[model samples]
Target chain A: MTIKHGGNIYEVAKKYGISEGEIIDFSANINPLGIPNKLKATIISNIEALKNYPDPDYKDLVTAIAKYNNIDEDFVIPGNGATEIIFKIVEAIKPKKSLLLAPTFLEYERALKNVQSDVIYYLLNESNGFNIDKNDLLEKLEDDIDLVVLCNPNNPTGQIIEKDTLVEILIECKNKGISLMIDEAFIEFVDKEEEHSLIRCLADFDNLFIIRALTKFFAIPGLRIGYGLLSNKNIKKRIINKKEPWTINGFAAICGDVLFEDYEYIKKSKEFFRVERENMYSELKKLRGLKVFKPHANYIFFKVLEENIDLKDRLICRKILIRKCDNYVNLSNSFYRVAIKDKESNAELIKAIREVLYED
Target chain B: MTIKHGGNIYEVAKKYGISEGEIIDFSANINPLGIPNKLKATIISNIEALKNYPDPDYKDLVTAIAKYNNIDEDFVIPGNGATEIIFKIVEAIKPKKSLLLAPTFLEYERALKNVQSDVIYYLLNESNGFNIDKNDLLEKLEDDIDLVVLCNPNNPTGQIIEKDTLVEILIECKNKGISLMIDEAFIEFVDKEEEHSLIRCLADFDNLFIIRALTKFFAIPGLRIGYGLLSNKNIKKRIINKKEPWTINGFAAICGDVLFEDYEYIKKSKEFFRVERENMYSELKKLRGLKVFKPHANYIFFKVLEENIDLKDRLICRKILIRKCDNYVNLSNSFYRVAIKDKESNAELIKAIREVLYED
Candidate 1:
């Protein structure tokens, strides 16, 4: 089977000749609490919305997102997903030279390459828990660069840049006349999300752009809803001008207002992740021949110390799927990522990994 | 009220202080038959699919589209909408010079402008019932052009380019090394879809591309599913390489296979449009000061011969909405387009127009 960016249970299910429901998926970092009851009820009731075109401007959705983010409605640009926003920003910016982090979410590189933007990676040191070095990163934001992207509670490693350091980088980019795009797709899963998100910085920094998605936190990845925040009115105008109309379907369009207001689901999800992430992290740390990185989000990342283990393949035999991190730049076959799911599923994954590594 | 592309019942409802369902929508050209029962059942039954990420490759959806069109699976590139595919193709091609119809679907111009492609228009002759001249159009396909776009059974005018004429243009484009994109978004609404569609020619012509959507014939515009067909392997690969993953949501992904297989819905829809389109055309022509163009699709385009009639606004007072075509590049305020809804709605629209023009 071809290696793919994870959460591909369809492929795995076909390969194993089993139903998709049989596979315990830890490959995609989604809120394991699942879709909020309120949102689901709302969507089911409004199913007839599929008959008409979605509101091209997506006014109600944008208004709700802006209210939730505490930013001006004018600052918000909603998209099909955070991925769409990422590509649109690159297209709008058409940057000559952009800076990215190695082993980040793979979509950024794809988006940059689409616009023929020269990409330079700022390698995060594994010794520092795959964290960005503040001074070193600031030094690299020279006048020559047109764009700089940072993913908070970053993918694969589940590490984050310090708030002060991120602010400093944003200021440096502003000073150097470079556009700063901060992808906070996983920010909601992090504790104290307000402190880690640059959404507040949008009021002061015109060059700062932040992207957020309901797919991860709301557990509605299939719904495809995300928004970009920027105080730069010109960029916002350009995006609106250039964007295709009604990319968000009517069902997804109404989700922001309903999902953002589901405080019960939000509270329950945070609590679940808070407890499960810690339990899974500690359990995995107990295993031999594994070096688990402390995770800040819903997923844990680790490197295998033993040779020729083939953990992903072995786990698949037990009807478990975990992300193999080899495809990620600067990460090798020995590295892997797994989502912290429900307690029972997490325990099953732990048992499967133990059987593969220690027993045989 | 700001002039917008029609079918925006949200804005209209707000402006009139009325519920959306109260207004009869004629602005958007959707099937009068409404959403297929099979598709609705499939979507509702699989609502839990929203818990997982959509397959990034959208293999099932693409395969279904290919099988339905009798084309190669590799030739299909599914997107959020026909609109998204339009933007992606334009971005990928980066055409130096492109040709389009003056009063075509508005999104093509927006897509072309996004890539800074020089747009040249072939104005349909108003004197000839807004139809394209075959010989004249062929003469305009010069070697300097990089891309050519055709909207079959053209929007607003409801006219189709002859199949033979279209084939000649395709051969001409191939000889000139110009890429041809035929948008068949409304083709399923046409009486003879098999003859009108260019899907069969894709295997032979590398330069030929066609865009299709379930939004129209399937009556699921709010669902947002569309696919592009092209035999050009390089172009398809480039699009896949550049495209952001999971543009099609999971619910929309499963739709292609189910919806395309709904032959009962397909037969009912075609029969409905065939009868209603003709009935409405004859009814519209009976009006004293209206010139109704012969329609090939599910909508009728006509001109109000009298000046200062304000047909759209006057009908709006009667709680009916019709597309005022002044926003189209070469269309004027006197021109209007209306969907061929069910018999009752069609009668009400005809009655409203007669009342507005004759009584007032």
Candidate 2:
């Protein structure tokens, strides 16, 4: 069964008979910096872009993406969002047996299953900080596994694998003729993102497929533009042949032309997240009966120390929404995730958790 | 091979060293009325809609579509475009063998091919006016054919199937355990559309599936919003389960909130097309070497009488683009389709054709 995702403020608003504006949403890990001003200006000025069919080839968008990533245009495959990219890449590979991290982005498992791929899980241990251990995972890299999908700064945990370790796995997978698909959806939120990202390794490793999203970092989840990069021209050709035309809407198709060039916005957002993430983490740790984990991305994941507490429901009483991670594989009702929002919102979130835990 | 679709002024402009604004695009049959002003205002006002994830269920949008069509909301499944609906419905059915009109929408064949379905075409005869004869079609619905796909006011021909004939096909399909998928993308352009639409028959016939697009009618093809209507709850649930989330971007999602309410725009556009389609059809018949087919929609279909003329290339010399129908099955190099634009544009199109055929 597919677990309903969080960040559905619309559903909550309707259910509670309140306006969407009234609720504080920390469920989806979206950037607090909001959409870039330049992009908004671009969209309004070019509102007529929707007047005709989007360029099916999306030449300008592709060129921008290629330039942004410093990768060849041939390596990029744009999608409606990173979600569509996930499904498309899986469909392209058609793996028989795939390996994924437990409590990772749920979409990867869903995408794999859609292709009738059997999924194997490598459980991240709480005792070991929910971090992927190199040798431990390497042991699970049996000959039978055809594909390995990793979510960098993995969802619900916010822990990222070091570049060297990631490269080791990539090399091993290559030797075993296994394709490694890494989702960099939140890679931009992490400090020194390039060090953690394997996108630069694409030319060196034909087996590597990296998926990235403008949704989370740019905070335009509703606009829907993301892409996958791979050096394999053969698979890329096959994917283009099978994929639907113009899946990316007009606004999304042209966003790359302005978004990649927004250097000030990118730098400011990076610095803001760097400060807010640490502040939120420290504040959460001050509360009683809460085990807060160190977060690398813009969201923090932790477990409730107290038993029989209903932390999520309690926090929701204050109209703040956070993700309950129990639905993820190998996770329990004790685990929860919350976005690192703006400074004021983050403080309110910390205070709410404090009130829910100690005041009640 | 997938035929590259027309109306890509982007590709044509780049190749010809001309700006997109310089060319006259008639290859894509978009409404000359352009986008509704009310929807554009709504989008500009709610620019923040793109800041967060769109409603995963798209309740408001779905409600609007249901109310607009007078169909129960349960029967509606929204997609990025009518093209996406084509692919999704075919994927859900997974038919082993399907029947399609030879010169219908190319996407159906592509969608069918994606599912590894064996496609059999019923070649539309020129002598029959490219019309589907009830008896001729019924005979082709052998035991092996599980699906039948039709493009009403059939593409590149603009010939429509009457309600009585369509009902007969639907009933026969239901009796044979075959699903009849009809593309009503051009139905809105047809005179007295309700009389030809199968939407009313959806309640009575479980085998009936209908697709409609806001793209052509609203002239927002780049925004990409369309839907499928089916009485089958089981299939609807399955499609939703397998489908990716938020394929429709935010602007497309919210446009429905305002668009369906723009009754004046709808009425005016219908009247405009009514006058323009006829005017263009009558004017085209005056051309020296063109055999004009009576158009039931906003586009006219015709065949060049002259031999070895390269009509499409000749028109390109004047920067006037019309769909070259030769790429479509059963359509020869002589076949072409052109959209009916506003008065001045229509005259220029006819004048250009006259220049190509007679003046040259």
Candidate 3:
């Protein structure tokens, strides 16, 4: 069987005989505000520009990223998406033995496998609501571990590793000669993202690799643009030298032209998700048969308390799609993740999910 | 120095302090006709759809490609571009000893190098108009060579390897247990493309891999979509299993929704490039200081007869950008390739070259 990832509304839409437009997808954790109006106009205007190849160096795209993050341009490497960066980093590291957070983002494990790395997972404790214990992670970091990958505001669980905790891990890994890679794909969704992010510590940690994406927050997963920030120039050069050219599509290359600077859209989306995530989280917690983990980003994760419930199947029957987390490592069939969408969609999902629970 | 590829109007624009819109680019061999009007409209309509992740399976895309080529869907593997397919094929084959046409597309060599493959070049003799000597190439295909790559209607030289010769090479390579990859990226620009393409023989040779791109023929290089065709499902499966997911962007994936079926646009483009390529070829041949090779695609390759004249520098000063073939293997500073553009632009380029030649 294929190991499916979330955001598979295409498959669901086909299977359920529902038009993609009709389906309220709680599977993909994308921005509820959708693509910014200005970004759409920018894309339309640049349609004719598709005749030319994107800059091979992606100089302007890099500039936008560096300026947005207040980092030097040399520290940024733009990619097709954060997924591309994850794979490239693994290739550059060629880690012989790596440790990853179980129940984190799935791509890192696949990437590690590509490099033939022996992967040891520091399984996040379910009883502890899938939180990463700093001391426990440090103890798990052996000298033989060449790399450690963490998904900040970890996927399917939505538990974030605070900035100070990340620094401790970075330092411990550095001391043990292990590289640290943090994927902050959904960080912008959280309040006080700067306080939680290790961007300021980038210069101090040459071994650090931070993955960011325009996919979720900007709601352009289809456009496929993301970037990585690293202090190590050698690894950065290795990635640039090794990657396939023009991987960034023409529209995607110009995405940052409006994305990083769309202050209004950014503010509006953060505010929307902030309210929706909380409301959705509380609603899910109100359900008697679910144990909702406190969400850190734009998605809420919960485990069905009742056994053998087939909740995803039931929810799909009601034309509401939610991510079944069984495919993720250390996750089970009872574990499900639902994206916090717009107010109306959230209400529909909650109602559908409630009906499924009550019917069981 | 950076090994530059064609279609870098971005770099030229920055260095020359001219707007990219003003520069008539002859470096890239894209279709003379810009993107299809229907495609532009389809993209705009799907602007809101960018919020959703593109169908991961790309079913509609695969169907369009399969239908267009009259091949089984199993035989096709869609990629970010032909460049991505090149890299993926090299990774899947892991060829220890590979033979490639030296003046071919540069990406093949770079891809081969990534796997540390021992690259032996079949240097197309410039004195022989860069033509592939069939007998010489056959003799060079030793049993020990694991892979062989050829760019039909080869890049920078514009010489084609006919179907019969390609079949012979394929059979010989198969017998010797060597994989054969034929890149037909520019074949559509040639009249009777089917006659020159090895596509008909694909079923007979599992070792055969054909790379096709919409970049040049469809004139959407920035959109980034291409595919590789092979009869070997194992290798295809290997590629799919190993590749980074969703490498093809949303807009690029849906490109086929209009591209393959747009018979009117395809016919018009082919008609345009056919006349343009001939006119451009003849015009270049008439130049006093150049020896133009007969072109098979929408581009002409030539050598500057006069020594110590910086032709590219001179032309760029005239606000025209053409490919300097110095970076291509087995090609030198005097070598150049220029795209066959619209008639007016072609005339402008010719006039500029005439001025540069006489000025020298």
Off by over 4 Å in 3: none
Per-residue lDDT of model 3, residues B1-360, tens digit only = 145899888888888899988888999988877899989999999788688788877888889999999988888888898999999999999999999888888889889988999999999898788998889999999999999999988987999887888888999999999999989999998899989998878788899999999999888999999999999988888788788888888887787869998999999988887777788888888998899999999999899988788788888887889998888889889999999888999999999999888864
Give per-residue lDDT, candidate 2, residue B128: 86
Q: Per-model i-RMS in Å? A: 2.8, 1.7, 1.8
Lowest summed lDDT over 10 consecutive residues: which window, candidate 3 chain A? A1-10
**Per-candidate TM-score against the hidden true structure:** 0.98, 0.99, 0.98
Could you give candidate 1's per-residue lDDT for residues B268-324 as a string of tens digits? 889888887888899999998998899999999999999788898888888999999
Arranged by TM-score with the best first, the candidates are 2, 3, 1
- In Å, residue B12's CA in model 3 sits off its true spot by 1.7
Clashing pairs in 1: none
Q: How well is candidate 2 docked (DockQ)?
A: 0.70
1 or 3, greater by TM-score? 3
Determine which window of 10 residues in candidate 1 chain A has minimal summed lDDT. Answer: A1-10
Lowest summed lDDT over 10 consecutive residues: which window, candidate 2 chain A? A1-10
Model 2 over residues B1-360: C-alpha lDDT tens digits? 145777788888888887899889999999888888897898889999998888888888899999999889988988999988999999999999999998988889998988999999999999988998999998998878989999898987999999999989888898899999999999998999999999999888877889999988888998899999999877787788788988888888888868888999999999998888888888999887999888999888999999778888888779888888988999888999999988998999999999989989
Q: CAPRI verdict on model 2?
A: medium
